[model samples]
Target: MEKVINETDDKIKQYNVCVSYFDTLQECSFSCCFPVNVKPPVIVSADILKFPRTEYICGENFALDGIEAKVCFSDNEFLLYNYGENEGLFSSDVTTLNKTGNNEVEIKIRNKYNNDGFKYILTVIVKENRLVSIDIGKNNEGDVYFRLGKQYTDKVFFDHFSVTKHFEYNKGMTHDIKNNVVFNFEKLQYLGNGSFTGVLYARYTENEKTYYGEYVCDASGNNRIILLTPLPVSLTTEKAESVNISNLAQKLKSANITYKVRYQDNTELTFTGDVFNNNTYSCNGVTYTINCNKNSIWLDWKADKMDCKETSLEAGKLYIEDFWYYGEEDLIKSVDFKNEKTLIFESENIIPEDLSSYFSATVEYITGCKITINGNQLNKSIDKENKLITVSYNGLKFQHSFSYSYSSNGD
Candidate 1:
């Protein structure tokens, strides 16, 4: 009987039998039983690698994700490091890799039945670290952001070259490249909140052959690129403030209100306001005033303003143009002239004295003369005399010693 069972088992194995049923075969014709064949599990090919091998720093985050295979890494074999589950994907944050020599990233995977499928071996080529220029936040937590701002200073860099690269990292994660240059400025403590509102300035000195960069800020709480034209060029804010022209209601049309533009390098553009649609705007190719139902924000002229002969600007585009002005016929209580040709006008805001608010008029004759306002203290003597004017500011007394000249010169 034992010999018969052995013969049956052999026959079953040879025929690739699916089941063993001894009752189906007679003792004389009995054969062996065999199990069905099982196939080997499938293995997925996964890898780990660095992006740009040559960079300035090493401690910076090295991020990893979107891995479709089970993976693990270790400095030693006794302690096994598992990264993904059976038939799962994995990733990693910034971690130290082998600085020199060959570093390997090992991986193992299992199939549906949890059977070992295959193990993969990967190599990471770690290169020596180098020092390059960085202009954004520190690389501690690995995440950072930056924005354009207005800042004028001499400390940030060389006299001619400036840095403008903004970067952020966290757990070694990288951006989608499109938004790489843009970063949030609030989180970086080294780059103060105020600096984000300043411009990213750079200067490259030909003599020194060095590049320097800094952030510049405007007085009106905005950070803009120092020389680079802002992206999207212009932005229109909903009018939230009322523009009251009733004060100059009398001098509306007959005498053009002087328009003054303050530009880079202390350059100024002066023109007169032209009234249209109950709003007054300067005539220079760069500025205009718009009156909306609710609010009004300054809209800059587009880049094509010089080529296009239209005073009307696009509805919601951003451009840098003139906004402020001074007129030739506007009443002046005081006027003073300096060697550089300074002429001060007299105007006061409607604020109480205790409020620490003082107003003075500035007369700008585009590329001509800029009058730096000293003070606007009520000149009772000038008001009484109707011609003589006197003003005081910070212990400096200035009197009006000039007359109003309105020669349009065919203007």
Candidate 2:
């Protein structure tokens, strides 16, 4: 004998059967089935953060920290809840997006059963910000301090990184509200001119970005000189023994501009060509010149860009005044001064012996202490008996005798 039961809709039914006992029953068997319904895992909320889009200031990079997540979207399939993201996963780990305005991303999580789950799509906005200014300063002891921002922090600040100077401006600087540190100038001050190449240095701070204006200036003592943006071009070789114009043309062919190079003279060559399709120009510098002839190519470099003719300056043995630099330091290249005739040395007490001693003490001192040096305007004379080194330039005369002095600093 066997009993069977089933339930549905809050109702039950039962039946009993005998095996091989009834006239029509030969054998019997039984089976049962049940139903169950389980819901899916729950998703709390999706967090989205909007980062500040701006340029990097002197000491400021894009803010890699400080992200506030907001519940913007969630999954529609499940009973959604609100739970903050895992602390370690969200903090200090922001995606460095490209220079675009909008970014979209997807995240995944797991439920108590470890079942894979997903949430609604999240969107992030990224903006374009480029570097505007870099300011370096020093305190009393020459410790460097730099702050980057779109607004100026203080006034009367001193810069000691390279040269320390007191700074003042007519109109205060401005900062972009939308971008925390995009500096917009209000009033620029005009600083005095530089001796070498006439490049001016101006000092000002707007927003958080510090401005050490170079190259130009305004009337209110603000520097107006803008820096040159770096070029995409680079020298292919360490030492360019020779330059092939045809090869250069093939290498750098963009738009209608092509580069051509040729040697003209041993010391002075001329080049008439274009690099980026600007104009056919000529250059006279230390290395070589690229001059284009009517029918052929010509590259030339002057042999004596810093050569002075042989002459004697002896004004009654008081020393011949031929050429003179204001200071005892070496000549500086590319400085435009109010007066080139007047030589000015920043350090008044510097002497030739001290300069030579410093050079000997430091192994790599050649690149330090940059000054405008021009040997072309100088006249040199040698006294065989006294072993004297005499030089005359710009109506000034200098003479010195060498004495062998050995120091423990060098062999």
- Top model number, lDDT: 1
TM-score for each prediction?
0.22, 0.23
Highest TM-score, which number? 2
Worst 10 residues of 2 by lDDT: 314-323
Error of 2 at 102 (Å): 1.7
lDDT of each: 0.32, 0.30
The reply for model 2, stretches above 4 Å from the true place, is 1-85, 88-94, 112-115, 139-318, 321-411
Candidate 2 lDDT over 38-100, as tens digits, reads: 333344564445433333322222342343344322334332222233333332223455545
lDDT of 1 by residue, 193-244 (tens): 1222223423333333443434434345343322221112333111112333
Residue 162 of model 1: what lDDT? 30
Cα error of candidate 2 at position 385, Å: 43
CA lDDT, candidate 1, residue 407: 28
